[model samples]
Target: MEIVNSAKEIQEYLQNTRRELHENPEISNKESKTSEIILRELEKFGNFNIRKNVNGNGIIAELIGAKEGKTIALRADMDALQIEEETGVSFESKNKGVMHACGHDNHMTMVLGAAYLLSKRKDELSGKVRFIFQPAEELSPNGGAKGMIKEGALDGVDAIFSMHVWPDLPLGKVGIKEGPLMAASDHFTVTIKGKPSHAAKPNEGIDALVTGAQYVTAVQTIVSRN
Candidate 1:
């Protein structure tokens, strides 16, 4: 009850933080500035045992309860995609060719908001809470989570939780489920070799572009047709 009201009180703070992060987006494994801003903001809380530069540019802020209980972890990614921003928003990305296209800026801000609210009620909590600001989440197959875990980010932690923004939901609404809400992502690379020849030559060279397009069409039907 009181915590909910506290959250409302910090609405403007969270918005400002989100906008600041959005304007200076950084790509995966290259979030030094992003981490610095988050670290500075976390410092204002004054009650967290903060760990900096965890597994590169990640930050772990842990808050312990006054009593004995389980430990829960909250995670947020700190990476942006290599996409140009055209939102024309007041706080559009200043980093050309890079943007928070996947809403990681919001994710980070949401976790920070949770940290603020929970820190205020630390005495009432029964267990420990770890707010993990992870980097390189956009780099699938070799994400920053692996490095952070290797560096013991999850050590002594009982469970972890995270969320992503869905535009389908209306404002002030959140969607949840009983099981896994998102699917796994994997990547692969395909190389096509073709010979190049003069434009006037008749069928002397193979066309890699056409071959690649045909391969893409064939791959698309693996789920729909098969």
Candidate 2:
């Protein structure tokens, strides 16, 4: 039952897991394979009830502590971006035009690592732990968070802990924020209209490219000024 012995051993073990996920990154709302692997791996740890396909490819797992205190949750997002990987790594993304550039693969691995660690120390645990593998964290206006919450992802959870890996924060170091740790995420699209004309034409059509450029610049200042 010992997948790894010490910290170094677990590090290497999780590295391989992360790499496997990174090489096969799946986009939002399309994480069937990723969920399959995660479900398969989590079952090996034992002592938990696992459920899948919650409002998409989300996985919910519950680990009951030996003693009683409060039910806490740990969550991870398992969605990738629609970007092609040019890193040329050996385990580069297999899904072309979709990559784990946002480090969601790392996020999934970290939660799984926590699951393993807590499983080892479950006897000393004073509460329950829920491992939530969520999908579509990047999709705004219709994110998986709302769907999962609607499906009772936090029905009886006292608190939840999740993290994103930051390069500025060195390994073994953690950063904490008070008040608001995240900004409101919103998405919008603007279509600038211009009369079609030949490339060499002058004064024959409005320059939508310039208009859009100005619009982008104007919106960017909202963050700084506010």
TM-score for each predicted model, relative to the true structure: 0.90, 0.86
Q: Put down candidate 2 lDDT per residue, 1-226, tens digits, no spaces.
A: 5544544568987999999999889888999999988998899888888889998999999888889899999999999999999999999999999999888999999989888888878798898999999998888878899999999999999999899888878888999988778666877789999787778995798888888999999989997999
Model 1 gets an lDDT of: 0.93
Top candidate on TM-score is: 1
- Total backbone clashes of candidate 2, pairs 3 or more residues apart or in separate chains: 0
Q: What alpha-carbon RMSD in Å does predicted model 2 have with respect to the real structure?
A: 3.7
Q: Residue 10 in candidate 2 has what lDDT?
A: 86
Error of 1 at 24 (Å): 1.1
- Backbone clashes under 3 angstroms, per model: 0, 0
Point out the worst 10-residue segment of candidate 2 by lDDT: 1-10
